[model samples]
Target: MQVNSEWEVPKYELTEFKPKAHKYCVCIPVINEGEKIQKELKRLSHFASVIDILILDGGSMDGSLNHEFLFSKGVRAILIKKDIGKLSAQLRMGFAYALSEGYEGIITVDGNNKDSVESIPLFIEQLDKGMDFVQGSRYVPGGKEVNTPLIRKIAIKLIHAPYLSIIAGFKYTDTTNGFRAHSRKFLMDSRLKPFRNVFSTYELLAYISAKAPRLGYKVVEIPVAREYPKGKIPTKISPLRGNLLLIKILFGLLFGKYNPRSE
Candidate 1:
């Protein structure tokens, strides 16, 4: 779908579950998140009336996101990615669709049932207050976390958050958290071409983290719970390889590699 003439997005097939019913939407990116996606949607469906729900599927063959289940959960639409890309490509598709559908803002959360679905309203409140970007954090006053891996925690606290905080000139406690919100104005900014093919993996999140606050957009961090289950964590990224690539992306962002050049 063409959000605007300037936008470019990955190829995908769109499936509609219902008509657009709200000004804001929740865009969840998933792949093979069987029960986790189902559980997340069920809990999130409580607020479906207030905000539309969308799924960006990365060609999941896990039989988790069938049309009947999604329709029953009040999903507004689903975009099954047929293109060769990862999380960021799916995001490009989701954001473009949301903007084209005339959504005023977008709230994005992980599909893996780890984040606080209850704190979704808090992000909505920030967006309604004219905030352009909002990052959710489990390290803040009212935020909570359970069963978070120690190494992952250490990397985020020591490396990721601090590096980005310095770049943005704003303290962000949870830089890696995908639980965030973005306004149409911020996403549509000419200086930040978020729809590009460059943001294929873990780059866009890092780019947005630093780029938004540095551009002097209205950015805020809200407290939210991120719980980890005691057993297996549902993550696609392998720890060693994923962390290295993320670090590379962070450094690239620092050097302005992802920044859109002036035409």
Candidate 2:
């Protein structure tokens, strides 16, 4: 299976389920990504030989990713049908679920190919080096954002970056990027719970990163390669609405309104 410049997915030959071979488990939360789920799945499935892989779906309509398929193919899956909120809520749900199931660490990625799944190994390697949280940043060295529109890029630098830095009280080039790794101990640090942003996952990450230094967790970002599709995959959010929700999360953090559950 070779992927070309045109972004074609090669045929995947299924293999057996083997759980005793790996130490970590990865959790991906996706919603209504039928066309691209398999590609992410292929990236995950191939890597599952070295780690446990699980998919938490937010009630996808086409059902392209179901338990029967994942079970037969060795991937664990969980499907939910609560339209409570946005990306952050779904991820909170997924991470909490994966943690309950005894995963050592968690990696969150966009369902789209915007991030290359191959970076997982690098994330884990860094985790072993005494880092608690690892983030993927396009602005970092070796990290490149492909197919990013001019307007979005401008908005990120001009608006989101500054706003997030002040609100989260940390300086990060790409506060909105979803590709990240979190250790089990980091996840169990309940001081960062009670997330408010449901529209986008970045809000939750920013909240956590802001509180990480206080929690004594070492946070770091590494350069990662991103590939964007010619026609961007549809997000479950409109940019305006997503930004509005993000603002709410920002102010929530600013005014001392957020109170996470006790650890």
**RMSD to native for every prediction?**
1.2, 9.1
Give per-residue CA lDDT, model 1, range 102-212, as digits (tens): 899999998999999888899899999999999999998999989998878988999999988998889999999999999999998888889898989888899998989
What TM-score does candidate 1 reach?
Answer: 0.97
Top TM-score model: 1
Q: How do the residues 74-97 of candidate 2 rate in per-residue lDDT, one tens digit apiece?
A: 575553636455566667666655
- lDDT of the structure predicted as candidate 1: 0.91
Q: What is the TM-score of each predicted model, taking all chains together?
A: 0.97, 0.81
Residue 254 deviation, candidate 1, in Å?
1.3
Give the CA lDDT, 0 to 100, for residue 76 in model 2.
55
**RMSD after Cα superposition, model 2:** 9.1
Clashing pairs in 1: none
